[model samples]
Target: MEAILRIYTHYFIYYDIEMTQYANEIKISADNPKIGHVHKPNSEATLMGVNVNINSDGLRDKEYPVERGQKYRIIFLGDSITFGWGVEKEDTFETLLEVKLNEIKPTEVLNFGTGNYNSEQEVNLFFKKGQKYKPAHIVLFYFINDAEITPQKSKWEFLSHSRVITFFWSRIQGLMANLSESKSFKSYYSGLYSDDQQGWINTKKALTQMAQYSRANQIRFDVILLPELHNLNDYPLKAEHAKIITFLNENNINGIDLVPFFSSVEDPQELWVAADDAHPNKKAHQMIADFSFDFITRGIKWEKN
Candidate 1:
């Protein structure tokens, strides 16, 4: 009976720990009017066994003050890919890039990446919150889905603090989205390649504004085009990619396309977080960091004194 009691005690302890961990997963607040959502500042959460922390500025990193003559600040702006979803902060490409750039010169890469952020929201975030940082360079990690408009906040958004509810809700939403044969999904996935949709137009406008802002501030601006995993193999969105490239060329913005490099891989599937998630894994992040390091040091002329 003593052995049975010991086993029960151990099981209870393990169960409690598991519950606590899951409970910490939900750390986002939906009260932001500018962006649909923002990370809860100074909060810690765990997702896919990876720990994430949001600083006082609601960024993914720890508190970092922006000051001139100390370190060159580079702000990375984008969606979940740049946010390092499904990976720890240290495993993120932004952090890796920071480390690599610091080797050449003192630098700080501020991660302003937030999940579910579209180009419009990202641009808004930069103008409202990020501009105060006064970064020397801005890197926008452009994902195809970034063209989509931000979803309106629902009443259920208030329950986002509950990890259990959020997790199950997310799963249900994913399932519904997959099963959806709606025109919106079809237009987004298939029609976007050929048609010049409003989303694409808005995305271009946002990018242009961001570029213009950078030019006005004398900050170097670069766009890193991140491709979807499936699109990498067959290149379903060639037309869309070309349009973006043309836009960048016209705006005189530096665009780094990662599709060719990612597609050149023997197996692009290996770079994904999981079969379902489709977010880039650690290998992909490492490759991006390496490529970006090369681009920053060799491709662009930096006035690093």
Candidate 2:
């Protein structure tokens, strides 16, 4: 009986509670022709058993005025991780960092994160909506997959109804794709930066545009490269990280890699939302907030010459 209980616990945590199980019911995304998509304004839903609320501005934070109003306004851009997927809004690094920074002075860190957002979409979103916030600083929480092309929602309606089928179908498709390309996960990730990949090309252009705009406007801008939390002890994506950092340096943008802070953990899975879902949990978000608080408060000068 004890052994059966253990097995059931394992299955529930590692398999039954996966993101694929709840992907169907989350209806926060709204189609936007200009920048691909954005979260539906004033939307609220339960995603992966966590409450997700979108403000009137379509951001994942509380609504704020367009004017800075003597507050040091900071805007963060990224995908789901930055959106605090599987985590609460208060537990998100952005919220934590905002609280920490406000201790020093008046500050507001606005979260402009969305799921499935690539660099192009993020930058475009900033120009379209985020600029009106009059942020004094901008931070892009860049994940490894940000260079990939924007993904369209799957049109398979049936898959949405059955979690079991959705899970199996995803696994099967992934296996087939890997087999057909003769590519492992490492190779597949590294291949995203190939010279011919339009996604990577567009990513570079988008980042460059952001850096240039930030400089011209005198807004301090930086990129915090969020690591893939799958494995931290022996990270296999160092090469990809270096490639991104080099690009940032060439474009005169500061890239802060957060891998070392996370890699120090003995077991990376402890920081995950679930055994199967690698999105950072509340603990990981706290660590990020602590580290970022120091960095942001230091007022490091990023010279663009």
Candidate 3:
């Protein structure tokens, strides 16, 4: 009876912990009208054996000076993946890249990633807060789902306490969404890029805004396209990639597609945060950092001090 009880306790704890932590750490930001939410300032959360600490400025990284002081600062904007998700802060690509770039010259990479952010929200956040850092460069990690509309804060706050309940609820919601739209995941993602889709339209508008701002301000800007992790060997989202690249080219924005980087992985699942979470693991982050390091060093024309 004791052994059986311990097994049950472990099972319950494993399922419920992450949900509770996420709820405690994230808050709806009334000030963030465009992004809709932000991390709780100076708070900490542990999810899937990883610690996420938000600074006083409500950013995931260490506190940085508001003023750029002779250091070449690079600002990274995106959703959760860029936020490091389930990965450690030191192992994240942003941190790794910062270290690598600083080897060549004084550099700082500011991570402005927020979970569940669409393209519009990311750009909005940058204009609202990120520009204060006066970064020399900007890198937007564009995930495939970033074209989707900004997700509203969940109304079922009470259910967040129980991962079991949240799991079933999400499953039911997906079922309803499928029933309503009758579209598979691939079809749904493809539909987001359709000419009439407001999400895609707004994404383009936001990208254009960022690109123009970068050009006008003499700030180097690049968009690194992040691939969907389910299947990397034969990525099925090539069409979406082409569409984004074409738009970037037309707008004179530098774009880097990262899909090919992970294609060599025989089993993409090995790079996942967990069996359930599709966010990249440490290995994947290292791969991104290595590739980004090479790209930045090769492409960026270093300004002599």
Best model number under lDDT: 3
lDDT, model 3? 0.82
Better of 2 and 3 by TM-score: 3
TM per model?
0.81, 0.85, 0.88
Ranking by TM-score: 3, 2, 1
Local distance difference test scores for all models: 0.74, 0.79, 0.82
Report the Cα lDDT for residue 301, model 3: 63
Give the winner by TM-score: 3
Q: What digit string (tens of lDDT, one per residue) describes model 1 on residues 1-305? A: 43553354344423222233433343354555557667777877655556777888888887887565577788899988899977778888999988878776788888999877888788888887798888888989888787776666667644644445544665677688777755334346555434467766777888899998889989989888887776566777766677777889998999878777767776677888766566898988988887777665555444544
* lDDT per residue as tens, model 3, 148-179: 98766667765565545655666787688778
lDDT at residue 252 of model 1 (Cα atoms): 99
Ranking by lDDT: 3, 2, 1
Candidate 2 lDDT by residue in tens digits, 26-69: 33444554377677777777665678878888888998998879
Clashing pairs in 1: none
Better of 1 and 3 by lDDT: 3
Q: What are the runs in model 3 whose C-alpha is more than 4 Å off? A: 1-20, 154-164, 173-183, 303-305
Count clashes in each candidate, considering only residues at least 3 apart in sequence or on different chains. 0, 0, 0
